[model samples]
Target: MSQLPKRIIKESQRLISDPVPGITAVPHEDNLRYFQVTIQGPKESPYQDGLFKLELYLPDDYPMVAPKVRFLTKIYHPNIDRLGRICLDVLKKNWSPALQIRTILLSIQALLSAPNPDDPLSNEVAEHWKRDEQDAIATAKEYTKLYATEQ
Candidate 1:
């Protein structure tokens, strides 16, 4: 059988040993390339105090092509779609081989702090954020309280 790639192994080890604050990524035993992730919502944001779940998968090409990641927990952000897909540059056109799992996770966390209404995946959510930001934030906070509470 082929062995796990050196980069993947190294990254997995680093993730466990030197993890980013508010983010935890652990590879599954059955599939080393697949990871179960949990991101603590950033302070002062609508998602604060909530634990957001996500899934990350490193493709065969890996560093050559960015990892596939998506939110699993319910989040009311303009950049994240109803299906949990994110509209982030690094995850899309701006990705580079030099980027890493840690960086991407950090980016996702930052996105929580700053939701861009202009570039949105969910048009409805974007409209809400644009038309009435305060109301949208209130709604997001309510959702975080209702759906993202620790289980």
Candidate 2:
């Protein structure tokens, strides 16, 4: 018997009806567990005006474990690695069963606005940010312009 999780259906409906600002996520029709996502960079950050793509997947035991999320867009951020893995506490050890997809996406969006270099996924980017914030920000903006534009 094919059974769709009630929670998943509710989440999808809510996401479609009341989408978050600057973020769009819709589940795949073929596979409800997978979602294609797009997030607009925060205006207050160097990555502003950039469009980032991402993929989200919910495991069978979703609320028991955090969902898997990865960026399809290349971002020049200290907490995001070259492979697009985010080094965020909530995405990892801090995740709670109570957290929903909207909240998780919101946290990811917030991370773009406030990057913490002290604990980073890309050591090189963090070093550059610590050494010269202006230069790092310029580099980030350049990367955004180059990579985040429509192809």
Candidate 3:
């Protein structure tokens, strides 16, 4: 692998030293561009009390192109598919070079807090959410309890 960019080095350092309140990102020893991340579910959300794991990877042309991010832990959200692909605009069309790893992860955390069924990655889940929001939230909570619990 080529030498890591100075920007990545600095971002990794800050992530470890002055981490986000409910998020933690640690790079792999062999590959600095790959990170193992964990996010605490936001309060009052269906996913509350859960801890979701995710993987984030910065490509060679990062900052110019958005970093690749996907949930590793199972979650029941309309905007997140069964394969864990998230339907967040910032990760796609709205991405900007100014966005950092921390900002991207924070956006994902916020997604968990406010799921958008209207623009969804998982159609089935979106339909479920649209049909009965309360039941969908209950299902989300059930999924969180079953999958996102600490081990």
Candidate 4:
């Protein structure tokens, strides 16, 4: 691979040294652009008490294009598909070059706190959420308990 970008290196260092609260991102030794991330579910949300894992990859054009982030741990959210693709504007159309990995991850965390069923990646889940929000929250909590618990 070519020399790693200075910005990526700086971002990686800062992620380690000044980690975000309830979040941890660590780069692979051989692949600095790939990160193993863990996020603590926000309190009062269905995902609360769960620790969700995710993979984040910065493409060559990173910052110019949004990073590719997907949940590694299973979660039941209207905006997150079965394959773990998230439906968030900042990760797509609303992305800006000025945004950093930390901010992106924070946005994902916020998504957990407030899921948008109206604009969803998982239609089935969205329908369920729309039909019965309480039941949907229960299912989300169940999935989080079953899949996101730390070993």
Candidate 5:
């Protein structure tokens, strides 16, 4: 068995044992290294009703490197590019071995609540965010309502 599977199994157990509000994860039965995660938007954000799905892939070097995460659902935000790549600090330079899946998901939820325009992955979204916070928030709400709502 691959070491990645073992790590993911342990992480999933930890997530289940000590659940994080607004976030949950489960590995695919066919592929242990790939996980499906759901993250509820933070309470105070315009994305409050949003339920975002994420695809996580554990690299061979897990603890030493951050897992690759992508938004499976379309998300229009300053920190997430058009391609759905997230630009979170912890997922990059700030990553540490101590970080776990639960913490990362929580951080993503927090990121939605408070986006950093200065370091944005989507330039247009960032410009809107910097120029007008209210309009940006409104647009985010519109996107959440249009794309993120559950059928």
Candidate 6:
């Protein structure tokens, strides 16, 4: 058996032991470095009841380097671009060694609740959110119903 990195193995164990509410991370059976995550939308948010999938890749130099994360599910949000890239400070410049997978997923869930218009990945969505909060929220709800809802 290929020996996995200590950090990755420990992180995986922690995720399994103390899972974040509404979020699950399962490592690929073939590759321990890659993980699949599913995060449920926060209650009462426009994305409520939605289940979003994401793929996470932990580099060999983890803790020093942040994991690569991308949404596998299509989502309409100001901070999420068309390609599913997220614009969150914590994922980038603000990342700290103290942060873990559960914390990252929780931050993402919070992002769905309160989008950051100041720094938006989707300009049109940001503009809509800035100009008309109600309309933007309504549209988000519609998207949740249409694209995010399980068939």
The runs of at least 3 residues in candidate 4 whose Cα sits more than 4 Å from the true structure, single-residue gaps closed, are none
Task: Give per-residue lDDT, candidate 3, residue 133.
Answer: 98
Q: Using Cα atoms with residue i matched to residue i, what is each candidate's TM-score against the true structure?
A: 0.97, 0.96, 0.98, 0.98, 0.93, 0.94
Q: Give the alpha carbon lDDT tens digit for every residue of 61-140 in model 4.
A: 99899999999999999999998999999999999989999999999999999999999899999999999999999999
Residue 107 CA error for candidate 2 (Å)? 0.5
Runs in model 5 deviating more than 4 A are 1-6
Q: lDDT by residue for model 2 over 6-106, one digit each (tens)?
A: 99899999999999999999999899989999999999899899999999999998988999999999999999999999998988999998998999999
Residues 46-106 of candidate 3 have per-residue lDDT tens digits of 9999999999999999989999999999999999999899999999999999999999999
What TM-score does candidate 5 reach? 0.93
Ranking by TM-score: 3, 4, 1, 2, 6, 5
Q: Rank order by lDDT, top first?
A: 3, 4, 1, 2, 6, 5
Model 4: lDDT of residue 33 = 91
Candidate closer to the true structure by TM-score (higher is better), 1 or 6 = 1
lDDT scores in order: 0.94, 0.93, 0.96, 0.96, 0.87, 0.88
Clashes of each: 0, 0, 0, 0, 0, 0
Better of 2 and 4 by lDDT: 4
Q: What lDDT score is found at residue 15 in candidate 3? A: 99
Q: Which stretches of model 6 miss by more than 4 angstroms?
A: none
Pairs of colliding residues, candidate 5:
none
lDDT of 6 by residue, 1-151 (tens): 5688787789899999988889999999988889999989899899999888899888777778778888888888999988889998889999997888778888989999889888999999999999999999999888888878899
